[model samples]
Target: MAALTCRQVGNDFFKEGRWREAIDKYTDAINLDPNDHLSYTNRATTYSKMKNYTAAIRDCKKSIEIEPKHIKAYYRLANSLKMLHCYDESLVTFNTFLGFEPNNNLAQNERTQVKTAIFKEKLQGAQVHPALRILSWANCDNDPLSCKARLLAATLEFNKGNEDGKNRNVKGLIEITEGIMLDERCFIIPSSINLAVNTAFEQNKALSPTLSVRATILKYKQRLAQDGWDSVLPALATNIRAAFLIGYMSRFTPDVRNIDQGIENIRRAIELASFATEIAPVATDDINSIDPILKITFLRTLKVHLMEAILIKYKRNIEMIDLFDKVLQLAKEVIESCNENPISTEDTISYCAYYRGHLEEAYGAIGSAYNERSKFSRGELGFQERDLKLLLESVKNYEKANEYFPSDDPKFALFHYLTASYKLMIGGCTLHEIKQHAQKAKECEKEAYPVFGNYLGDIFEKSMVFQALEQLKRPNNIASDDKYFLPQACHVSSNSEEEEQRFIREYEARTGGTIAATMDLSQAAARANAEFLRNGISIISSDKQ
Candidate 1:
């Protein structure tokens, strides 16, 4: 009873700020009831005040084991553990205190502080991983599992490349790419230009060449070429590489070797396909009856043929302009045959839109090639990038194209650019879409720029230049300008001196005309939008970046 009274007195003394008296009383109580929790807890706190942390911790643990819900005992254990530099153990003690007194304000705050410390430590550890660990938060509208499964199936489909197999991959590839574009993770992974560059050097025919599968694909290629054909093998080789490289390895800068190999491969694909078109030169054969997969693949290959030819023939690049030309000829046949003979056509409007974009992409590249060759010769631009005059005339050629067809129809989109360019070529392209079309032309160049950058086309380069100008005008330094995307815009000054002065003033207030001055600050809040792609500037944005 006397010892118990002594422990009570020790608590009263400790609460009353009588340290010496509390120490004497707690020692007496500990001697009387050595295993009693309150006696040890009070004594440990007194030892802690005496700077005996090891002794305090040992006693505190004994008290805690004897009386688990003793809040004061836990606080003492935490303090003693911290003093001994066992911070992790101290955090555990705080957590224990929190569990018992869930509403305790001080304990909650301590737990939060400890949790934050642990999270920071883990984050610091992740910094050493090779591939960056990026984090984002989002929710899926539909099924994320379905999306992933579909992408996986697309990957499997892409491994098979006979004309039939290749066509099968398109729908899946489009589906996956479109979904990924809409997905937060996909853009985070990267999209088109990077994808195309990576694909430029890859082999597409088989994932792992099973001897049987290899023999089968080889036989199919041989059959397509009819054995004596020289170009068929080369073209198949090119298509296989294009599909492989473009399908994988996005987000890294591609090597010049990859670009060269890609150009070579694409060229072969077109040449081999061309053999089919040239066989009956008199135009006697209806090319539409060619296998559906072969028709679309060949047309698609031909469309990109200009892009391939430009990258390789460095000096004689001018030949690229004449070598490349378009014919919705195959597409129109497909559309017509589909309408007339429904059972034969699997051609979707998306396919038509794809080819339409294909035509524009080719035209865009051709215009770029001519402008590039002209620029290389150091004189003047020979052709306008967008031509309204030719489009107006081409309208007659498209006479049978639906009479009530909305001008926004894919055909008009092509006509719009061609006409705008034709008018501009003859010094008459007046519509603003001429410039807007030029911008869309830049969008088409999205696939080319990562591989060829501004070197691909003049209008393409100009579009890049305009984007650089806007980037220069952007508010801060966090935004980086990709000189490769719009290399032409790097230093754009019209022969007109007045517009130059105005541009200089605006640029001065923000970037100050030098990389040094601009890089130090983040970009303006307006242009630093999360979605802005630093890969290329689309100067023709319907709204600001």
Candidate 2:
């Protein structure tokens, strides 16, 4: 009776949010009745409220030991484990709790979250092919017809389609397109809505498969706008995934209409993702106020795809300064959030590493965007200062990206080569600076050559040679007495053979015999120069990276 009285006092203190006092009272109760399970469980709850998860876990385990069938003890134990990012243990504990209370919605949601975390962990270092295989396994659920299942299936098909598009496999494209079409059928509302959202869609009644899919998407969007997101929360995952995949897959072909469609779909996905976060109730006081992991995963994926769209638009020479600004803003927001709290727990450590990698990619994209804008600015008069500033900004961002990126990563060489290229393009660069950048570019090409030998390495080497040649050919920049300075440009002429020999000789003399032994710079320089003239600048292709 005395122990019960102490526990009741402790409960009162807990209700008043006097965590330390409540812990003292609970300790009194435990002292009076050493094996009392209720006192232990109550103390565990208090400890958890105090953010003392280790203590909470200990008490929870004790409570369970005293009463094997204690359901609350199991739940508390699982939550404490999850808070510490002991996911495997947390998963086991949740399964035990579910065995006792199988229909608990909160438990089910949490279990699904854990599964998603495990899935993401599995994907950490996987390459594209292995990632596809893992995604394939994820799509093999028993209830494959479920909304979430369909989303996973659609994601797999979209990735396969993307890979196929890269390889220019027409039959594979047709098959994946058909597969995506089948997946779209799952999202069609059973309502009596017509194919037309406006007169434009109505006029084209004999719609192609793509148009039909777009119409279905429009109907779903209309339903979402009419009825609040809550009304379709159950299908939100499928809807968002479908919208994003459809947009991203459109990039496979070079069709302007398809690219436009892709951009619209990606924009919609970003909007929906933002809305989802707004509507979600605040679950914590931490940086991740929503369902942090899941909600962040959605936002991250959508934003990255939006960046991809920006790159696609840039590649096609469409005006996308606005898009570039939007991505820079978005990336800045993510980087700021990721910078906020200090790492404390295992969960925080993992989140930091995961987000750091994305941040590296984000910086890389920003660097490339700035570089492209610099090139674009060169075409207009009186923007030389702006162009130089943009180039400097590009250099700054690329250096930041290198700082965040792992030195041993295969992509590091690519970024290094990029940095080297832009560094040389900086207006009024000193001769010493030129040599430094040129040497760095050569080193990066050497490192990447073995790995990307067939096509990518050749491209980098040729581009570097062309940039170096252009710099050397600038008559007023360097003294004529300097060995690296050339009196005239190495222009290709009708006498191809003689010009080629002269170009190779000039390149060797300028570099002081440091040129690659296997390099045939004549054809390489011509091709690079032609591509440079056509594209204005060689923007980094996000998809290839």
The candidate maximizing lDDT is: 2
Alpha-carbon local distance difference test for all models: 0.43, 0.56
lDDT by residue (1-545, candidate 1, tens digit) is 87899998998998887878998898898788776788888888987886555567777888978887788999888766554434567788887876777788877776666566556645755342211111110111112223222222222222211222234433333333332222212222324333432232232332222223345355645655574434343334334433323422221225545555545444443444454444422432554544322444434533344343443343344344433222223334434434443331134322222333333333344333333443322126332232334333443333323232223233333433343333333332122323455455445445223212232344433433344333433323343543211222213332233443454455556555554234211122113321233323333332322
Give the deviation of candidate 1 from the true structure as CA RMSD: 24.7
Deviation of model 2 at 515, angstroms: 28
In the range 297-374, model 2's lDDT, one tens digit per residue, is: 446646655776766677566266776787687677657645652232234322222455556767887887787777
Clashes of each: 33, 0
Taking all chains together, each candidate's TM-score versus the true structure is 0.28, 0.43
How good is model 2 by TM-score?
0.43
